[model samples]
Target chain A: MRRAFSRRRKPWFAIAVTVAFFGMLYLPIVVVALFSLNSQKSLTVFKGFSLRWYRAFFADHDLIGSLGFSLRISAVAMIGSIVLGVALALGIVRSRGKLGSAAGLVLLIPLITPEIVTGVASAMLFKGVGLPLSSGTVMLAEVTFSISYVTVILRSRVAALNPEVEEAAMDLGCSRFQAVRLVTLPALLPAILASAILIFAMVFDDFVLAYFTTGVTPQPLPVRIYSAIRFGVQPTINAVGTLMLIGSIALIGLALLVPRLFGRRESLSQLL
Target chain B: MSETSAVRLDGITKSFGSSVAVDDVTLDIRPGEFFAMLGPSGCGKTTSLRMIAGFADPDSGSVLLGGEDVTYLPPNKRNVNTVFQSYAVFEHLSVADNVAFGLKRRGVPRDERRERVGRMLDLVQLTGMANRRPRTLSGGQRQRVALARALVNRPKVLLLDEPLAALDLKLRRQMQVELKQIQREVGVTFVFVTHDQDEALTMSDRLAVMNGGRVAQVGTPEDVYERPADAFVAGFIGTSNVMTGTYADGRLTLPGGVSLPVPSRLGLAAGSRVGAAVRPEKIWLSDFEDGMVQIRGTLRETVYSGATTTYLVEIAPGVQLSVLEQNIDRSRREERWTGGEIIDLAWKPEHCLLLCETA
Candidate 1:
């Protein structure tokens, strides 16, 4: 009877699909989070709740080393991309020509191209330049790839800025450069911080790019987890995954909340 | 406050990609005087203000400030500040910091800057709210902040580009009066740009009416409103009854064969086309005085809006004349003229202007 009525109301027809979508999305994460507290290390067995895997995750030195390396790369990459991207966004927005628009469009290619293709291309570029694949290479590649995301997020904000503020600055007393430094950059601070949070979250647990660009010994945490999974699944991997999930969630929440703290309306631009 | 000209635009012309924004126009603004540039949108008023501010460079001519040519100087190099129509207050800074921005750039002592900023905030009446960001203030409050910010520097000249356009009508009127008081207190040269004729007429010591990238006339508000040079000026500054007729032997003959004597001192050639202009209020209904041009017409409509009654009189089959009369309670409920009644219109000959060609 509910199905019969659902055929008449279109929104009712979407209920089952919506439920299944959320169920598929969160069920695995919930299971992983639930099993990270299990006592035994079996894959399918229901066990009483314990913190043995969490303890094992804390005790592993290699995992801890990889986590630290990934955190450093994420921090460096976040700052690097933001600086370059803000400059690029400002330049692109102010430049007026066909060439400028063409450059703006070209900068968006990385976002549309498959991640695997970018990973393979970066690996090949490092090889061609005679640079060995190391944690430094991963940071360089991550920063290079993440710059487009920052520019894409920031360009609209730069374009939307009121040009009169700068003119007023100059009219008051400041020179042209001083106007930009004092007025324009300060107005764009909220968007810049929002983009930084998103970039940190994206670079922290990124797998495919880091896998291709990282060193042989001390890989990023996602690469480390992939390697450990291939050898044999450890309950410690579940604990690591749960921790990364929580961290990413916190970062995403911060990104969405910062713009609103500045009285901005809700927008998809808050996300990557 | 010297007698010399504070700002001058000598033969200024500006063009953008084949469209002329300001033609070869010349204007001189008096020192410490509140001068207004009045025009419709895209009539080069704002462009003229921007040129004076050094934000825009003219293709020809020069901008002079206090007898010095500063045409090529940038805004920071010049001693002029503008309050934009958008009220472009710095969102990141507090009200006091925003007001002190110019003093800081000029390297004033920190204590002096604070005292000056405090005084300006008091002048604009936002002293207690100095610590709040501009974004948190209301629209009227933000406008005051922008005003205080520009005036704190005490620039030699202040340019306001439709600064009150963003506020509500009541707030805008309030700002206009307060701005006049502030301008007097500071004694700085004010160059105001607006499309509102009332604002220009009320606040300006003198004004220039512009159209199509050219100055139509430059005069006092009363002079422009009373003695317009041409048809456009007469119609633009106020509502007027302008009728085209043929001039022959000191008399203009209308299409309906009603000939009224033109002022011969105008010196127009015989048999030349001319326009006779008169303001609505200048025409009376019951005076019948000597040397007055008298005519009769049937009333077509009557508009009573509490204070005044406007009567549309049809002088001919298709030619209508607008006559205005004050409603000073004549106890004429039955005697007041209604529609379809013949009425006499009378005005002095000097009030009936015979306009010749004027660009």
Candidate 2:
């Protein structure tokens, strides 16, 4: 009786549900991937396999410039958010009293607030302050939006760290700043790297904020693709989307792998 | 206390909100002495140790090291180091790098740093594991790493906050001996803190038994154990059977109307309530001698441990005393007295400690 209850039996219903779930999620992506390699410009039919759209995408200097623009924005936002985010995490975890707790609760607003709301508010703030809408504004908006992601991921890591380790560093002859540099930062590096990768991917794929805050010439890739799609559904858009999907997948993979490189086995779910 | 005391805390007190953590703690830790602060949890032993290491500032009074006041100095500026209870070894750095952290910060030359790190690792028996990350080491080895990391700095005084607390029983015992040996070899005044009475007794040259944010007693292990200062000291350092009763002349009258003769103490009044304590091993079940106080009681229970046996004997209603005996002469072990037998418990007069009750 125990063996019958404990035996391994496949439930066809669960298997079908799982298969349906993944198919629904990935079938559109698979179609885009397949059509990115199409030789003809027909959405409903598959043509002979060719890199025609990819070749066209590479030849378009405007699209290439947007791609480079998005990459630069993501890099800057990643570094900028990480520096501010890690410091905010340490401060929130160490500080006591109402101001610290209020700041902590306020930090979570961006994570839950609608991205479009933040984008509109940021653009209006820049305009109201007599600042022009440009790449700098977009970078600023992206960095502000991405700081919450970095801080949320890093807060628990900071809380889990032994406060005594920092004291031990200080006891070992390092000054306050030196203790953080020598001990606390190294301990948080794994989490920081993981969050940096996450922020990079999020900023790279952002559309609403970049669309609202970007300048006229070199828009972010997602905004450029939106403009190109509004004109006509170019097969080149599919190529760009496919490449971006690959890039983000690689970045997410790096986010999951970096902690293990630091000899920590924490998965991304645990981090978030 | 002498001016050359290695570490001194003069009337230090600390409070967190409404609860006091350490109150009026004044102590003089002599040079090259292995001192221990022994207490149960929340007794302010760790708080006092933190104040000494400059991690926590006292609400009042000053901390002095070699006659130099360090009350306001940060931990880095002070000549002291700590081995945390959790063995807070830096997991990111290599063992050698962790040991050399202080020397590097103090601008020690590279060659001298390497030499000192190598020597410290050897001293802690972690010579071959210098290049390994702390994550790969065992708990005992990690403890040694914490020890070597703190000890390598060669501070005027090394503060250990229950450093062996995370190890297993066998490993803790082994490390206790090893720690004492290392303290002697280095000749640095070690201010050890622990809650285990056995560890404190076995390792400390002098120890302060703390209770409720105050030093209940401070002396050598023998002084604290053999002659505790008061009721709290008597009950904490070892198992003591505290019998509360009223005293008159040279006799104590229990609540059950049974009267027993006790040694007259100077400060004890004729009609005052008092508590009398006697160590378990001091009471004997057989071979009674002259001038020994003997009482007949009914054996309530027998607890046979490996090296010793304890018998719970009820001398009066609601009054029980635990008498401990060595389990020597194994041939007579099985033939010993069983429960519910009438027997005599005897102890010398001086063994009964009297504490005058205030309330």
* Local accuracy by lDDT, each model: 0.89, 0.90
In model 1, residue pairs whose N, Cα or C atoms come closer than 3 Å (at least 3 residues apart or on different chains), thus clashing, are: none
C-alpha RMSD over true interface residues, each candidate: 0.6, 0.7
Candidate 2 lDDT over B1-359, as tens digits, reads: 43599999999999999999999999999999999999999999999999999889999999999999999899999998899988889999999999998898899999999999999999999989989999999999999999998888899999999888888999999999999999999999999999999999999999999988999889999999888888888888889888878899888888788889887888677888888888999998878899999988899998888888888999888879998888888423536676898988899998988765421
TM-score of chain B of 1: 0.95
Q: Which CAPRI quality tier does the interface of model 2 achieve?
A: high
- Give one digit per residue, the lDDT tens place, for model 2 in A111-208: 88898998899889999999999999999999988888888888999999999899999899888898898899999898888889888898998999
Query: Across residues A1-272, which tens digit of lDDT does each residue of candidate 1 receive?
Result: 34445445568557889989999999999999988988999867858999999889889999999999999999999999999999999989999877778879999899999999999999999999999999899999999999998999889889988889999999987888899899998888888898899899999989999998988979899999999999999999999999999999999888778878877664445434
Clashes of each: 0, 0
Going through the candidates in order, what fraction of the true interface contacts does each contain? Answer: 0.92, 0.97
Q: Which DockQ values do the candidates obtain, in the order shown?
A: 0.83, 0.88
